[model samples]
Target: MTSPTIVTAAMLAIGDELLSGRTKDKNIGHLADMLTMVGIDLREVRIVADDQDAIVEALNALRSRYRHVFTSGGIGPTHDDITADAISKAFGVECIHEPKAMELLAAMYERRGMEFTEARKRMARMPEGATHIPNPVSTAPGFAIENVYVMAGVPQVFQAMLDALLPSLETGTPVLSRTVRSPYGEGDIGAPLTEVQKNHPETSIGSYPRFDGKSFSTDIVIRARDATVLGAAETEVIAMIEAIGRSREKHQP
Candidate 1:
C-alpha cells in the first residue's frame, strides 16, 4: 500500500473589514488553489473580526480539527493588530518580542527610511516558540507555531509569504480531479452518482448543478489519486447520466 500521508489545513481570515463586506477576502481562494497544487487539502476556512475572543476560539477550534491552521490579518502596525496576543493566549504561551522578526523589520525600515516606532515595533511580537514566516513583499513577517501558520493581512504580502512557506511544507500524494459536463439535471443522475462513489470507496464522485438560463445540467467530477480508480469512476458516472436522459430533458446526459 502507498504510505499514508495527507496534509489538511484550515484558513482563518481575521478582520472586521472582511466580515462587514467592506473588503472582499481574496486570500482564501488563492490559498486553496496554491495548497491543492502542493498536495495539501484545504479542509475548511473561517473568517472573523479583529476580536481577541474570536481569534482565540477560531485558532483553538481549527488546530483541534485540522492538521494545519492558517491565519491571516491582525499582523500590522495599527492598533487593532492583536492576532499574536490572542494566539499566545490560546497556546498558553507568552507573546514576546521576537529577535529575528525585529532584525528583519529593523533592516527593512532602515532601507525604506521609515522610523521603527512603538506602533511599528508591534510587528516584531510573536508567540513564544513560534518561528517567523518571511514576508518578501513587506517588512512585517508572519509566524508558524506547531501546526498554525499566521500570516499578514494584506493580500499581496500574504501571497508572498505563502509562496515562500508552502514549498517546504510536507504534503500528501497529489489528488487528481476530472470533470465531465452534460445537459442533465442533478436529480436525473443523483441515484447512479451515489452508487459510483459507494462502489469505488477510494474515489469521490461530485455532482454540481448548473443553470445557464437556457438549460440545466450537472457537472460530474471524480477526484482520486490513483489514475485507474478515477477512470473507472468516470466511466460509471457517464453511463449512469446517459441512462437517465429523457426525451424532453435534452435527450442528453
Candidate 2:
C-alpha cells in the first residue's frame, strides 16, 4: 500500500520577552505534539522579536514554504502587540476591528462591568479577511489569514486557541513512533544505528543519548506514517542491539 502524503508546518514564536529571556516559551512543544497527532509534521521553528518587520518577514517566509504556519505571542492589548498589524502587512491586506471579535470582547468586558477601553478593543483588530480562532480562556481571539495562524502568547490561551483551531484544519495520516531504550551507550550503537537508518529509508531513526550522572544510555526511536514500515524498522533496531549485546558477552573476561 502507498504511504499517505505528509503535511508540513512551521512555528513562529514572536515576543521580545522570549528573546530577552524574561519569558520562557512553553507553546512550541505543545503545538508540535498536537500537530503530530493530527498528521502534520512541524518542520521549522523560529523566534522573532516583537517587531513588525521581523514578524512579517518570518510569516511570509514560513507561509510560503510550509502548508501551515502557527504563530504565538504579540497578539495582546498592549502597544507592543503588533502581530495583527504585521500579519496584515505580510498578507498585503488592511487591518480592521473584526465585528465578531469586537462583539466577543464587548460581551466579555460587559459581563465584568468593566469598560471596553480602546486598549482592550485593540484585541479585536485583525487583518482584513482573516478568520477568528476562538479563545475560550480569554475573550480576545486569535486569527487565521491565508496559511498563517496567529495565536496568543500566554500558554493557557495559546493552548485553548490551538485546540479550537485544529478542528478546522486539514490533516493527513497520523505519524506513528516506537521507542526502545537500551542500557548501551550511544557510542557503541551509533555505527549500527546509521546502517539501520540507511536500510530503512522509509522510516526515520533517531538516537537520543541520556546521561544519568553515573552512566549513559540511549533511546532509539523509529517513526513512520505506515505501521508496517515502522514495525519493520523497529525489528531491525532491536536485532542490532541484541547483536551488540551478544558480541559484548562473548568478549567478557
Candidate 3:
C-alpha cells in the first residue's frame, strides 16, 4: 500500500516578553491546532528574544529542516522589532518598505484621522520579493518570503494572519485520532499497550495517566491517517481494556 503524504512545519515565536514571562504565548497552541486541521504537522516550536543574530540563526535552521516555517512577533514599529531585517539577512535580500503594505497602512491611518509617522511606516518594511499576509484585525500586514511566513505577535492579529495564509499553502492528508479511557493505571497496560503498538505499525499509540483525587486512570490515544487502520487499532485497544477489566474483577473480593 502507498503511504500518505506528510507535510511538516516549524514555528518560531520571537520576543523577549515571552522569555521574561511578561507576555503569555497563545500563538503556538493556536498555530498547532490550526495547522493540524489543514494537514500540516507542526514538528517543532522555538521561542527567541529580540536579538537579530538569534532570530536569523533559528530562521535558517528551521526553514532548512521543514517544508514550512512560521514566525510571530518583533515586526512592529519599535527599535527592537527587527524580524524583517533578520528575514532579509536569512534570505539574502534587502528589507525595504513594501509599496503595497505602505499603501494599506497609509490608507488605514488616513481613514482613522491619524498621522502616518515614520515609526508606523516601519510596519511596511519586509524582505524584498516577499508576498503579503493580510491582517484583518490591524491594517499592518504580515509578510511571507519563500517558505517562511512572518506574522504579528499579538494573538488576535496572528490568528487573523494565519487564516489568510493557510489557503495558499500545500496540505497533506489530515490525521485522525481516537481516545479510549481505561479505569486501570498505566502499569496495568504497559506490556499490552506495547504489544498493541507493535501489532499496528501504521498507527501511533500513546497512554496518558490521569489522577482524579482518589485513583488513577489512563487515556489511550490512537492516531493514523487511514480510517481503516485507525479502527483496527482502536478495536485492539478496546479488547485489551476489556481483558484487563475482567482480570481485575476476577481478582477482587
Clashes found in each candidate (C-alpha, N, C closer than 3 A):
0, 0, 0
Q: After superposition, how far is residue 154 of candidate 3 from its true place, in Å?
A: 0.7
TM-score of 2: 0.98
Comparing 1 with 3 on lDDT, the higher-scoring candidate is 3
Q: How many backbone clashes does candidate 3 have?
A: 0
C-alpha-based local distance difference test score of model 2: 0.93
lDDT of 3 by residue, 177-229 (tens): 99999889999999999999999999999999999998889999999999999
Positional deviation of 240 in candidate 3, in angstroms? 0.9
Lowest lDDT sum, 10 consecutive residues, model 3, at 1-10
| Residue pairs with backbone overlap in model 3 | none
Measured by TM-score, how close is model 3 to the native structure? 0.97
Q: Give the higher-TM-score candidate: 1 or 3.
A: 3
**Model 3 error, position 121 (Å):** 0.6
The TM-score leader among the candidates is 2
- Clashing pairs for predicted structure model 2, backbone only: none
lDDT of 3: 0.96
List TM-scores for all candidates, in order: 0.91, 0.98, 0.97
- The sequence of per-residue lDDT tens digits that candidate 2 reaches over residues 154-203 is 99999999999999897888889999997899999999999999999988
Q: Using lDDT as the measure, which candidate wins?
A: 3
